[model samples]
Target chain A: MKRTLRKARLLLGVTYAEMMEYRAELYLWALSGIMPFILMGLWAKAAGETPMGMPPVDFVRYFLAVFVVRQMTMVWVVWDFEYDVVNGQLSPRLLHPLNPVWRYVASHVGERFSRIPFVTALMGIFFLLYPKAWWVPAPGTLALAILAMLVAFIMRFVMQYAFAMLAFWTERANAIEDLWFTLYLFLSGYIAPLEMFPPAVREATLYTPFPYLVYVPAKLLAGQPVPALTTGFLVTLAWGLVFLALQQVLWRTGLRRYSAMGA
Target chain B: MHGEHYVPEPMPSLNGSRYAVAWRRFWLSSLAAEAEYRLNFILATTNSLLALAGSIFGLHLFFRTGYRLGGWSWEEALLVMGVFTLLDGFASALLNPNLNRIVSHIRDGTMDFILLKPMDSQFWVSARHFSLWGVPNVLFGLITLGYAGKKLGFGWTEWAQGSLPVALAVLILYSLWFALAATSVWFVKIYNVTFVLRSFLEAGRFPISAFPQPSRFFFTFILPVAFLTTVPAESMLGRTGAGNVAWAGVTAILLLLLSRWFWRFSLRFYTSASS
Candidate 1:
């Protein structure tokens, strides 16, 4: 266990240094997530003109929370993995003592660390622009929200990594992810809050994994009520486990096909 | 000793006809190159359709609450969405595939060869390649416009009126994208800077007036996103005054000129790779 911990530490430290070298690019990536803020403006304006069950300020806060959650939970494993698989770069990594997936995880963790200052700076600018939306959550609620955010990040990472497994068979695996992202964009509360969704649509969307990715944690972070917190956590874990099992199966079978390519 | 008296020949002038021929060759070659990816075309079409459906569904949520966004009716807002999709298609087809390569050119020193060419560097870089993937979005946008226009009782005259602003919107968008992409001359590693502009342009999916006062100001003056889709939609609906269309024309011209000037200024800072 101690040796494994040491290895992880070394991997993360090296990757973190690599990520820090591209500080300006990382900041631009952070800035590219301003879609939530733009939507916040539209939602807030609409909510003011009508009774949308939440006030305009709540919409602002909700989307700010969404921006934070999105930044923390973003995953692009499919793009990287597809490039590696297609370029035969994975051949070298296969000989490593640890699973190659750990390398991706280490890099993602490193990027998240490098991105913290930029995200904080963006949040500061947001509050400076609209200070009326600022509020602190209770300590208990903050703790629960942090835990939910972490789970949401892990769940998203594992799910995309499973999708990345398809690169073993096809060169266009990222296209599939792009199609899935279209659905995620709409159903994941990236465009609007769940409360604004029609009753029937909201009920139906809750059954999908999309809402748990953004809505659950974002609501908690905004200090809004999440109808069934425990159930949300359970569903998230269930989906994560399903993907984890699928990834393992795909990895074993894919390695055979991968070697047939003379890698 | 003879090399000292060598007079450099005057280069051929780049007239309009020459530019037309060059653009045709550029697009034809790119299309031939892209024709190999049959599966990508199908996938791109499906992605565009799904994205359009989702956008309509999201817009429907607001109108279902008996609340109009920025006082725009459902059909009126659909016009805005249609315009936004059309511009997005144009970007994918031309601006994205071409301007996105500016960073790589600067990085790998291929830009040196580009500069050594006889033709205009800006024109060559901006019009070198086109992708076929965005054709579906263009068709879908036109279909949506027709459906919405029919519902709103729009005639050909209305369409003609709207075409001017729509064309200007394209010019404005191309200028914004090219200016952002040219920043690679200084910040070579910031390939995703155009993505920041793209996220800001997402606001064009809705009417500019739909945002709050401060946001509306920012979109209007800072980004000029108001001229992109909202003005065109309003012109189509006959809700905009002549003044607004005139202002949009002025903005488009000014922005286009500004982008050209900015490109020239940034080239002074372009120290070629390995120099």
Candidate 2:
């Protein structure tokens, strides 16, 4: 266990150093995630005129929480994995004592670390612009929201990694991820809050893994009432397990295919 | 010998017809190369359709609550959405496939080859690739525009007048993308800058007036996103004054010139990959 911990420390340290070298690119990526803010403007406007069960300020806070949670939970494993697999770069990595997945995990964590200052700065500017929408959550709520964000990140990573395993069979595996992302963008509460969804649509989407990704953590952070907090966590866990199992199976099968290709 | 001077002969400029031929050859070769990926075509079409459906559904959510987006009726907002999709299609088809390669060319020193050519470097880079993936979005966007136009009782004259702004919107979008892509010379790792621009341009999916005062101002004067889809939709609906159209034309021409100037300026900083 000590040895494993030391290895993880080295990996994360190295990746974090690599990430810091591209600070400007990282800032641009953080700025690219301003979609939630744009939607916040639109939703806040709509909610002002119509009774959408939430006030304009609530919409503001909700989307602010969303932007934060999304930044924490973003995943792009499919693109990287596809590149490595297609270019035969995975051959060298397969010789490592460690599972290759750990590298991706460490890199993502390092990027998250690198992003903290920029994300905080953006949030500062946002609150300065709309100070009325600012409020601190209770300590307990903040703790739970942080936990939820971590789990949501894990679930998203596992799902995209599973999709990445398709690189074994296809060159354009990222295209599949693009399709999945389209669904995620709409149904994952990224575009609008679930409260604004039609009643039937909201009920239906709850059964999918989409809402638990963004809505649950965001609502918890925004201090909005999430009626079934335990249920949300359970569903997130369930989806994570499903994707984890799928990824393991694909990893074994894909490795066999990789070796068969004379790699 | 010290006092002797040599004068170089003037090279012939390639005119419009030569450029037309070159454009055709560039697209045909790219199309042939891309046609090998038949499955990709299907997947791309499906993805575009799904995205369009989701956008319409999202717009419908606001209308279902009896809130007209920026005081636009449902059909009018649909027009805006239609124009946004069309521009997105144009980007994906030409601008993305071509301009996204600028960073790689700069990184690999392949840009030296492009510059050595007799043709205009900007024209060559911007017209190089034509992907088939975006054709579906183009078709779907036109269908939506037609359907919405019919619902709004738009006549042929309105469509004709609207085409001018739509064309100008294309020019404005191309300039913005080219200028952003040219920044790769200074910041080779900043490939995602265009993505940042794209996210900001997402505001064009809605009518500009739908946003709050500050947001409207930002989209209008700062980014000029208001000229992209909203102005064209307004032209089609006959809600915009001739002055708005004139402003859009001016903005398009000025931005085009600015992008041309920016490209030349950026080239000064482009030390090829090795040098």
Candidate 3:
């Protein structure tokens, strides 16, 4: 375990340097997370005085927290994995001792590390522009929020990796990803806070994995009373394990088929 | 082979019948190629419908709380979304496929084939591919617009006034896309700039009044998304005057000219990777 950890650390350092080479693209990718900020404007205006149980200040704080979390959590691994599988790029990694998933994990985490400084700078600008919109949560809530976000990140990665494995069977993995994205857009506090969703829709989504990926973490960070945070954490962990199992099955079957085809 | 390729054919000009025939052949071939993947076509149509449904749901959520989206009624918001969908469909069908093509052509040095041709390089690169798949999105947008128009009780007179501004907005949009894609001649690695442009355009999914006052000015003049989507919807609703339509027409002409100048200037700097 210690050896694996050391190898992972070295791999992460290399990926971080490579990502720094394309710093401009990375910044532009981060700028794409501005959907939350754009929606914040309309929502704040609509919530003129405490509509949907959230005041305008709370709405601002929630969305700003959401902006920070989304930048950290988003992974483009599905596209990368699909392209590699189709192009036979996975053959080289299969020859190595380390699992290819670990390399992907390293690169993703490395990117997250590289983006922290930029996100912090953007946060500084945000606070400078809207002084009253900023909120500093209490220590306990902040700790919980961090834990939830870490779990959320892992859950999302595993789920997306499983989705990408479908490329082994068909060429339309991206179309499937697009469908998933449409669902995530509505259910994950993207269009609006989950609280703003109609009662039936909110209740239905709580049973799914979508809210835990974004809304739960953002709400906890904003110091809102997440009455189901305990349940949410457990459910998120369970979904991660489920997706991890699915990925293992699909990878094994796919490797068998790929080798049979001499690819 | 080289001599034959270099010989100029006896054609009238770039806009001759031969070129039109070639264009028709390309579209027909593209249609046949895309037809082979039936499931994929269905999936594409379903995906666009899902997106349309998502936007409608967003409008529902906003109005269910009994709060106006910046003083616009539910139908007005739907109209704005309809206009956005219409223009966005046209962009996906026509503009987006060429964006990735031009970026890759420059990066991989495949642009030499295009530059060597006798036709205008800009025109050839931009019109080589069309996504017939985006037809469903255009149809859905029209359906939404029709539904909203019925609710608002729009008359033919209103439609006539709306057509002028909408036409000008289309001109400005095409020029804006041209300028963005032309920038790739210098900034070769910015393949995903279209996604950035898409984000900018997404703001047009709602009315300009939904934004704050300062952002209203920014969207109207600086980025011009308000002019692209919202102005036409307001024109249809009879809320805009003739003067606003005239201003939009002027902006369209100026932007079109600027884009032409920028494209020519950028072409001079493009050093083909193959040579």
The candidate scoring highest on lDDT is: 2
Residue B86 alpha-carbon offset, candidate 2, angstroms: 0.3
TM-score of every candidate: 0.95, 0.96, 0.94
Which pairs clash (backbone N, Cα, C closer than 3 Å) in model 3? Answer: none
Model 3: per-residue lDDT, tens digit, B61-122?
87888888877899988888988888888888878877557778888888889899877777
Candidate DockQ scores, in order: 0.78, 0.78, 0.61
- For lDDT, candidate 1 versus 3, the one ahead is 1
For model 2, how does the per-residue alpha-carbon lDDT over A216-244 read when each residue is reduced to its tens digit? 89998999888777777777778888988
Candidate 2 per-residue C-alpha lDDT over B64-97 given as tens digits, one digit per residue, 9 for 90 to 100:
8888888999999999999999999999999899
Candidate 1 lDDT by residue in tens digits, B1-275: 69989996654376887778788989999999988878878888999999999999999988988999999999999999999999999999999999999999999989989899867899999999999988888988998889899999999999998999999999999999999999989888776478889888999999998999998999999999999999999999888999999999999999899999999999898888899
Give the residue spans of candidate 3 off by over 4 A.
A259-262, B1-19
lDDT string for model 1 (A49-152, tens) is 99988999999999999999999998999999998998888998999998999999999999999998888888898889879988999999999888888988
Query: What is the CAPRI rating of model 3's predicted complex?
Result: medium
Question: Where does candidate 3 chain A have its weakest 10-residue lDDT segment?
Answer: A254-263
Q: How many residue pairs collide in each prediction?
A: 0, 0, 0
- How far residue A178's Cα lies from its native spot in candidate 2, in Å, is 0.8
Q: Model 3, range A201-251, lDDT digits (tens) per residue?
A: 988888788998888889888888775777776777777788889989998
True-vs-predicted CA distance for residue B116, candidate 2, Å: 1.0
**What overall lDDT, based on C-alpha atoms, would model 3 receive against the true structure?**
0.83
